[model samples]
Target: MSDVTANEVTIRQYRPEDVKYLMEYAEENEWDLSMYDHLAYTRIDPNYLIVAADKDDVPVGFCGVSQNAPDTIYFGNFIVRKDLRKRGIGRLLWKAMLEKAGDQNIVLDGGPEMADWYITHGFPYQAYKVQFYAVKVNDEMKQNIMFKYDTKTLMESMWPDLMKYDSQVYTNFDRTRLLRAWFTGDDVRVAVAMEAGKIVGYGSIHRKPNGEYGLRNIFGDNEDVIEALLHNMLSVLPEGTVVHFMMPEDKPLPKYIQHSMKVEETAVRMFNKVKIETNNEKIWFATAHTV
Candidate 1:
């Protein structure tokens, strides 16, 4: 243990060069995080993720607030060097994180072991543990679920109605920026379903490391629309892509999807403010990071 004191470190915004250290930090700790998460978080909100630097200016610890929408952020990538745990380093990082999120509704997924700590920090309501599930996609798997609605490939021009439709569900936050930032990158693809030219639901499929694919937030007006979005996303990806996603354990998966899906992970989703109102029925699957 370095026993590095808080005063010996400087806290500042994350820099591109610090990725190597952060990646190592996450790997050493056996966290579920990946390098893609670090880069994406920074790309989404450049100034939100703050890092602790030693006297040599090397990053020692870091935390990020994924700006989901105005006054709504997903708190993640929070970690400190194992040897440098305690000694006020985490406190400094937390202080900086809090400063970056003044009065914003903070959401995060953590293990039960950290529940008390989160509650101590002002998050009292515990809704349910996030459930992570994965389904393997192939030509046969595609036939299990029928596409009952029409879905369109997400494009820059449809952002306006997309925002309006998504806002109806995530009423607490204006998630236009969050949506724009998330559904990007060459390997990322999003599918949207509309009814009468109005947005109904949307979902995203993105390539994850190790040849697997991930399902981003899968929302819709009904089960049919949600299933259509999922079907469309899966259809575009190559055969045998393992798709993983998360949702509140209590949320029911479509019957067809439930037949083949398997739970892979679970974690507690917490919020510092009042619980956000969400229609779980409309959300077929949630972004995997909740785990």
Candidate 2:
């Protein structure tokens, strides 16, 4: 292992054949990642991810780039082989990411321990830390549930205003295209909460490659709207299904969600060039991939 120098690896565009090897490295690190979840991103931009290949052209590390807005780029899916640390492969991937991102604002979530490195590199502002939690759904928690608002699924008629609401909350970008892509798959479900004939909140959920479901973009104006959107989204899924979601470190989960959830991971949210404004108090985060 000591003889394996960082020079032995070279950065290159990701290939279809490299998916299996990349997934293996990700799984070995216990990452909740799947090609199915990232498909929306790659479909929109094929060059969204890059890999560091060994001397033999075998991918040993990876990084991903996604422009959530005209001025914002999010870097994620960072990994080097579990046994291949300290050889500068990750730095190579980082340099490549910087090159791709150019002068746009760079936003990313990374390990707390590595904050200093990122700060020195470029990202120097802290927005907030976040927790990604995993929990399973069952009939037991469905009791005493009340829907405070009427929930509507995504439709052709809802496009204009839906984008407006999402843009208002997310603030950095208009996710019309991204949201459309995320809400399209057969297994995906989307809900918009309404009260007094007005939009209050919205959410979405879908099955991941690992059989667990990803609850995406649960944004609401208040706890009531959040609760309704969450319950309606969950009610459609079968029992015994595991779901992954995110929350800011300062905010607790709504009082009514009656499941024992575990924090799957933690990372500090950071930005360079600018700290984008979001309605942080009102939104339950989804994936940092686009946020």
Candidate 3:
């Protein structure tokens, strides 16, 4: 066995003061802040946020996990400050959080590099399919598109209706807290598609600090509705903004998006479940993460 130092790091619940550090860390990494809403974080009772700090009381890494239900816990964000990497801080935090999770089902998405690390640490490779779509927004297109939706209230009210469509796409349902966080973030914008006094579909647009946008959790029945929602979402962005979408490989909407935008990158969605079994039958609408 390797003689790694025992417990040189301290792991504890996140404090309100840590939000600034978290935000700064996120900004440095180009991650969407929608995953870390201050108001929603305060509402959750259990200790979902974990931070690993060194002996000097400096936070070196952080992880956020949410209990979606009694049996399911979704892992949202995990990051290690660049300068503190490879010190086993991440593994320490992971093990500590997993223990806190008990026997509940745990789900997390990691990029190619982190996916490999997760696999080495007992997170099985479950799925492999995601397409990133990007569109260059220009002044002309912005003028043509119009915004006609109330983002805040529409997003808040969308949970139930969205759950109906989401259930058709995934076997398990445990994303309420996650959705709530996404809609509550400063960077996120929500829009709905309405027809004949009825709600048809909705789209979420997440804007990054660097002028890049991410399209998330887009749900609708028809192509026209999707297009309309997309146009509406893109209308408010600044000129030359690039909007991206990470969609499932099997979804037909990718083709539609490709016809309008360029494919930037392709990646696989890999998950590791410790206790809860995943149902692969339904069409998953959005990743919990906006990457």
Candidate 4:
């Protein structure tokens, strides 16, 4: 680990007082603050988030380690100022936060530019490359697919069914608390896919402050379940709205969705030391900065 304390840079646990600076960093970089807030609120422990500052006490970068389950640790929001990157600040920050994870497997979805850096440090490929897709909501696009299953607004009573599908779709991690918060939180709408009188899949749609519609979380066992959930979610959005979704590049869903949507960007999921088996084809959208 780099000795940040011995140099001009210092790494320390994040504090409530750091919110303003962190928010500014997030906004300046065009990143949504919601993801950071979500991680902060749902983190396994308070000390998992670490911030690095220059000798003058100005925040330079920050990173977080989250225990999605007791054994699965997720690395997220590792950002350094554009002017400060390539100077070892990010490395120092991550090294400090990573210690909190101990021996747990580390996982993250990062841009291609950082893939080599992460691989050099220990994280190797665990899944196919993922891409973000976007589209302007309209009548013609919404008519692209016919739902083979039915979907309804998610209910607290369906938590068990949601958990069942989540366990199958998301693999080993138990993200119940995080999923619940995201699904029921203000300005968010969740739909549950149903077939044969049981929940087969679920998805959450949230309108971002920037007027974009985020297909926040979508998971299912097959195309029919995903198509049903997506149809219900998209039906709620108004025309001309920009909708966003993420899927693995190797998955057929992207090709199906790209019939109306445009490719926005891509990222790769990497893991350190251990690869957590995940069903990449079963996911349509995932947490941008988490497993």
lDDT for each residue of candidate 2 in 141-258, tens digit (9 for 90 to 100) = 5665767788888777987878878877868667776676667768778889888877888888877765787777788888888888877877666788888877777777876554
lDDT of each: 0.75, 0.78, 0.62, 0.71
lDDT of 2 at 143: 60
Cα lDDT tens digits for candidate 3, 32-107: 4543354554445446788877676666678877766676665655877776678787888888778877776666
lDDT of 4 at 280: 66
Better of 2 and 4 by TM-score: 2
Which structure among the candidates has the greatest TM-score?
Answer: 2
lDDT of candidate 1 at residue 30, scale 0 to 100: 48
Candidate 1 stretches greater than 4 Å from native: 1-8, 27-36, 66-70, 82-88, 142-146, 259-264, 288-291
Q: In candidate 3, which residue pairs get closer than 3 Å at backbone N, Cα or C atoms, i.e. clash?
A: 169-282, 169-283
> Which is the winner by lDDT between candidate 2 and candidate 4?
2
TM-score comparison, 1 vs 2, better candidate: 2
User: lDDT, candidate 2, residue 222?
Assistant: 86
- How far residue 97's Cα lies from its native spot in candidate 3, in Å, is 1.4
Per-model TM-score on C-alpha atoms: 0.82, 0.92, 0.74, 0.84
Q: What is the lDDT, from 0 to 100, of the residue 51 in candidate 4? A: 82
lDDT of 4 by residue, 1-291 (tens): 222332688888777777567766777775644542444345446666678877767677888777666677878778887667778888787777677788888888788887898898888755667777776767754665656787899887889888888878667777786575456556678888888988877888876656777776688868778777877877557778877667776666633355555455577888887776767667767656545
| List of clashing residue pairs for candidate 4 | none
Ranking by lDDT: 2, 1, 4, 3
